[model samples]
Target: MHRFKTLIIEDEPAIRKELEWMVTQKEELALTAVADSVAKALDLLAQTTPDLVLMDIQLEDGTAFDILHHHPSPAFRIIFITAYDHYAIRAIRYGALDYLLKPIDQQDFNGAIERLKKQEVAGLPGRLDIARQMAIPEKAVDMNAQICIAATDCLQMIRLADVMHLSGEGAYTKIFLQQGKRITASKPLKYYEELLPGENFIRPHQSYIVNRQYIDKYLKSGILVMRDQTEIPVATRRKEFIINCLTTLK
Candidate 1:
């Protein structure tokens, strides 16, 4: 009898530990490699395609959304474990196979496991059919899952594509957008570097990744001028790259 080898993709340390406990408590299931973030999970999946993946919807790097793109399982079976309530019902109705909400009971878990066993006899849904249709909300791009920004005393909605530049101060990243609107968030520049859409932004200074579309003008001395006349001090190291980026325009 082959055991159901499971891989857990979760960011929270305590949560990951509990998942390991859940899998081990079952006689028919065995725990496999655990990943702390989506990138690590993607790498591990390339090497060891587990029979089942227990995923947390919210992750440090991004959401468990990318997993659905794999369709059934890559190895394809997926069980979403989320704290958010509404997504649970959506997960099941959308043919996700199953979901386990937080504060998980042993009985509910055992039931899901039994369902997994039952599905094996019936054959699982072909994940390929659903994987092809995974489309994100397209109004504003949020590939990194960084949505709301805290500005002054209020939190404001933001789209990654609308942000024109990220300027790093001591501990905060000042986000400059296309409409001459600027906001500051408590997150660091390194955090934005990981969260921003990579191709659309280019770092010309230690404090900046000027959005390519918003570069109003560049002078002979390599100073960047925004449409609103906000002068961005470009780093000496990034002169050529910035020049090339501006010069190669259609």
Candidate 2:
């Protein structure tokens, strides 16, 4: 691995020193610059982009989010630092390798550093906008429980919500929406599980996917129900997790 260089963008001197100590302790990393404000960070970025940045969300001038908004990376990587567990900050952190919540846990810090070290910025897949990706299907993709389908051609666009269940058709997948609208997607069922909002869905089998809101009731007899009364067989082993997720809705 190449020697990783780091920039610490933090407002507090004590925290900055602590981060510098941590970085130097790791033989692979070199602490290059410390900026208490975004202006200084931006100036350094203009001169040279570092391998990684240990960035605090709130700065004297602006947020790390603001910095990220203006400058994206691979030329530079970010490890967010925040005192709060705000969801908006979390979403941004997800786009990067990791984050260090303030009073950073040593274990999490070590874990984050380890993750930053292993990353091949080029290999991590580029991001997909949540709205655009969700729009690939249609109607209630964001919230509202309406049936979702975007018909753009001669062929019908199947409503995702109408889906009774999803089943693996080999390595590919089939969407089993109501009124017998079964469509095939090149992606795997696991892909949809991650993309879909968890509250509205469930993974009952390695080969099958389910929508929890459509579930009528579950029976220990091993069958799950849908709005149309479609019966989906649940893999006994997957029942616990699926049951727990479904119970969260109630």
Candidate 3:
């Protein structure tokens, strides 16, 4: 029985503790070191080479990219962890690396571990380049914009325009699509709210962010009617703003 040495780099204490607990649960994984910042991560990397690194894309001092770039030829497998952003997902896919969105699910975690157990990593430079480009904070052109949505068995790509609405349940969000389908994503509603095109999407309620194009009508009862005929509540405070956004869209 071989145990893979693993390092976890995350800033949040609660998240770090949770990851530590999860790592302990896996008999095949051995937690070597945990660091909260890029500088500390570098020091740890210098001390011991881990077989796998569970890194947070965004760190306090610098990003996980900084650490990766520091090591020209990284021998370890990297599994990026982040809140919920499409750009990071795209980069991870491009790099042939695995990623787990925040509010990590046990199933997804197990799946990623299983993949690492079987797959041989290749194209390190290419993947790293894509990640670097993604971290630059530029909105991708609409036509080229693609979101990697995680499902039970695989990652699916969906167009931005096809997303009808998003509903939040604590840390997870359920994305409703125009094709009468829904996918549960392991990211918070706030994550998608910030990632989606602002001009077309609006946070009508704390639990819901609706696509303006899919909105059919706004009822006086502070409810929005979707093209799919789904009734989503509009926050009292955001009613005026929602109405205004709808008016502009019209």
For each candidate, what TM-score against the reference? 0.48, 0.56, 0.56
Which consecutive 10 residues in model 3 have the weakest lDDT in total?
A: 139-148
Tens digits of per-residue lDDT, candidate 2, 119-209, equal 5565222321221133222344443333222122212333345667788766567778777777676556765666555656678877777
**Candidate 3, 1-250: lDDT as tens digits:** 9898999999989889988999999999999999999999999999998999999998999888899888867888888999987667656653446889898888999999998897554545555665575565584635244466654445556766778899999888899987788888876787677666677788999999988888999999999999889999998999889888977886
Write down the lDDT of every candidate, Cα atoms only: 0.68, 0.66, 0.81
RMSD of each: 14.1, 9.4, 7.1
- Best-to-worst lDDT order: 3, 1, 2
| Backbone clashes, candidate 2 | 1
Task: Give model 1's clash tally.
Answer: 4
Give candidate 1 regions above 4 Å deviation. Answer: 70-73, 121-250
Model 3 residue 122 CA deviation in Å: 3.3
Report clash pairs, candidate 1: 71-127, 72-76, 72-127, 73-76
Per-residue lDDT tens digits for candidate 1, residues 1-250, read 7788899988888878888898999888888889988888888888896888888877888777665554443544667777755433333322334678786667888998886775542223443232222223233433333344545544455655677788988678888877788888766787666544455677888988777777899987878987778888888888998888888854
Candidate maximizing lDDT:
3
* Predicted structure 1, TM vs. truth: 0.48
Consecutive 10-residue window with the lowest summed lDDT within model 2: 146-155
Query: Candidate 1 at 246: error in angstroms?
Result: 58
